[model samples]
Target: MPLPDGNNFIEKFAKSFYNLFDTPATIIKEKIVAPNQKTYPWYHQKFRRVPTIDQCYTDDPICVFEADMQYRRDRQVDSEILSILRQRFEDCVLYETPDHMEKCKHLLQQYEEGSTDWFTKYGDLGAYHDVKVAYMKQKHRMVWERRHGPVGSGMKEN
Candidate 1:
């Protein structure tokens, strides 16, 4: 649903920024192909030949408002989806979580259809990729421990 009075940016941005930066290594790609927020980060920051952001700031304002609103919605949706994926990744690491936790069919309907479930799991604020990697290492260590039975246990190999 559209914003009650009109679309707003900060409100929408707050709900989506976390998922926007999940891929720390490829922040630009993540922003460009944000799935929902497809507007290039460059688009916002780059100076435009047709009109400057300042020029467009208060011109009509509604159009700008709508555009900004759309941008926020897109980013929020993208971030929410990515966040769900991130959470699943973390869960997989800590709890040996399995794959295909849920299908996308239930996403907009179940997740952001006024649900916007990202708030509950938003903690430390930067654990997506790092948690995923650490989890991988955890599983690796578990496997190694089982095979070697401790590094200094004298389980020598020829």
Candidate 2:
């Protein structure tokens, strides 16, 4: 009989191995003594810099309130901009046909080859922006794959 996919074999092996030692490993780990919380690196690095609620009380409470309100407004504006960009990015990817993808790739090549005004040549700003974003995302993926091997090669997860 023909063998199943390679992933199936690996999954089966992993499951069998886990089943064999899962209980014993848990028992051993639980029985071992854990180090003091103060000795842990993250405990000192994270907690030492944070101020408690009582520590935040100040003589000029109005200034603190105003500062907090400004901070919240800035965060809200940032979140709105991020949401817009995400929508644009998704629309660019979702609506791209194979021909459009190829054109975007060619435009990227032209831009890389000293045609700095490639976007202006496209006329429509929305189309130009979408193509540029798609090209950059593709380039990023290519570079990542080159550095770390193909997806699911046991180096990085999906």
Candidate 3:
């Protein structure tokens, strides 16, 4: 049925305002997902799927920030190792191959066996413990800089 004609200016204004803001029942119904009473593949049902990285970008800001930080940290660690290796070996070409893979395997074995003479066995390319300590210090500095707007910025460390 058609709405009754407004009797006065106040009624007309009220009707107009209600019409502007009121949502149709059909539209609200369309938004609601009714639970499936029967298990059927053809029926419309809400299915939960794992969120992709693109979805995470908009959905979780903290997760995205943490992932970016981890990526940067890993890149810095790799760069440090490469820089040290290049400084020690002038003509060394670092590439992954079966031989290199075997060398890594052997190194891991030696490390697990409590051998600390890796530099003697594999040339003077610095100790693994020293490299790890340096990486951790660098990473700590990067995190501190990010949180406190860089060192020497008049921000006293506490």
- Model 3 has an lDDT value of 0.49
lDDT tens digits, residue span 67-109, model 2: 4444344434555555555555445546675555654554444
Per-residue alpha-carbon lDDT of candidate 3 for residues 1-158, written as tens digits (9 for 90 to 100): 65567767888899877877675654555565344234557755533334322335556766555554544454455555655544433322244343555545544443433223322222333444333343455567678778777656856556
**Cα lDDT, model 2, residue 39:** 50
Each prediction's whole-model lDDT (CA): 0.50, 0.50, 0.49
* Model 1 lDDT tens row, 45-158: 442334322334554666555554443455456676777765655554455434334433343345444333343223233544232333345566567778877644766464
Predicted structure 2, TM vs. truth: 0.28
Off by over 4 Å in 1: 1-58, 97-158
What's the number of clashes in each of the models? 0, 0, 0
| lDDT at 103, model 2 | 43
lDDT for model 1, on a 0 to 1 scale? 0.50
